[model samples]
Target: MDGLIDRVETERKLRNVWHWLPDAVSEFPIETWAELNVTVADSNAPYRPVTRFESLLQKTTTVRYLRPEVALMEPCFDVLYRQVHDGVDVTLIDRPNCHTYFLSTYPERSSELLQQDNFTVLEHDELPPYGTGLLDERVTISCYEQESGTVQAVIDTDAPPVRGWAQSVYENYLSDARPIESRL
Candidate 1:
């Protein structure tokens, strides 16, 4: 009863992508905007993180890059731009080809890793609301748990270009969507 790839066991792992740089001092600066929050979901959600990211890109005008996780690089097809970070070549979608990206790290243990490496937590709360303006407008940066545990960062936004983005995300992407918790 065994065959070549016929076992066909489709295993799922959560993934994530940050909207900030590796050395970013803080999270997306929440200025005159409304609110900020973090969200989570199951691995079998109807929409993939990349699909959500692509939707965001299509709605916005400035989003021009996406640095996806190592695991999803092959699935993240037809990106417009590519960049090399720490000896790892990453792909990003920009402008007309805008897309999403994920990091190959865990948001929960990000704080601990920061001291060991030049990493920053992508949590929704710790991100200084008054520090650097990492995001020009509200953008949803998303990812999955380190070990495919849960879907992290769904409502990851700085300032929503339009109202109801959170609501929209909840409806389309989130399952539990715990607010103001540090997943990264």
Candidate 2:
């Protein structure tokens, strides 16, 4: 009789726990616009977190950008330039190919951009073919479409684990990169 009572009690506890679980198929929004600082572009919905970074820049004292392509730099250049002008520390990492493209495409602007006291740009041969930005305590990741040459998606998160992982990746690349001025 004791065994039967124990089994019944266990089953009752299991049922209680099951009732507390969230519905997997529910249509409720998982995150609000403020919580999920994500932006999707392109036909396939790629991440483009530039707007989030721009907004975060207002409150950030330091900014780090890891970019693989020159084209990706154009959109955020104005915001970054303004931040650097306003005394925010900014670091940019990209490939040598991107440097060459920047110089060719914006010969005049490159001089002004590189001459800023608060700005530092580095080139790394082994930079992965994607973009990531660190603004203050938040991290934003941008993926691109190889064929369309457009941003696919940008994911922004302040989650501790995700920020830690992104910081690790940024540090690895930053260590391997050489200052663009040194190369010039």
Candidate 3:
């Protein structure tokens, strides 16, 4: 039976393909990062919960963040303040809007945040189209979909290519960014 043999061969190929697929069994979207002990730096959306970066700040020795929105930066101010006080190296790259928000709304606190020795604030006119951060060896990249107005983050700890790309993007931006004092 030629038809029967063909069916058997098809089934065998299907089984082989199934074995090659990854066995990911997690309910949360970014659970793989948690399993790998990778820190995720996600942007704060109005509808979503606070990002894990707040909790990771306690244990992270170094932090590099590119923040496009002032609202997203507000919640983590206190945590960053504490981390800088604890001698963590914190570098922030922000757009002009963030500086305006701080100077107009929270002048005193903003000054305190910028004046820390362990903290460095840089301003850029335009940044790469994504929000990205590095917490030690972990790299997180958030891209916004213009059509849907939705944001998604790709967090990786072990992938060399992803880490290299993130580092390259960060360094490129950092090179052209101006210090906050220069902007003042």
Tell me the alpha-carbon RMSD of every candidate.
17.3, 12.2, 11.0
The global C-alpha lDDT for each of the candidates, from Candidate 1 onward, is 0.31, 0.64, 0.60
Report the poorest 10 consecutive residues by lDDT, candidate 1. 125-134
Best by TM-score: 2
lDDT of 3: 0.60
| Residue 128 Cα positional deviation in candidate 2, in Å, after optimal superposition | 1.8
Top model number, lDDT: 2
Residue 30 displacement (Å), model 3: 16
The segments of candidate 3 whose C-alpha lies over 4 angstroms from its true place after superposition are 1-49, 144-158
Instruction: List model 3 lDDT by residue over 1-184, tens digit each.
Output: 6556554553443342232212321222332323233222234443231265456556689988875345445666777778888889988888876677877787887788778888888899987555677878766544434344233332334445555656777898899999989858
Q: 23-78, model 1: which lDDT tens digit per residue?
A: 23133232312243433344675345445454443344333223233333333332
Clashing residue pairs found in predicted model 3: none
Q: Model 3 reaches what TM-score against the true structure?
A: 0.66
73-108 per-residue lDDT for model 2 (tens digits):
567667666777889998889878778887888787
TM-score of each prediction: 0.31, 0.70, 0.66
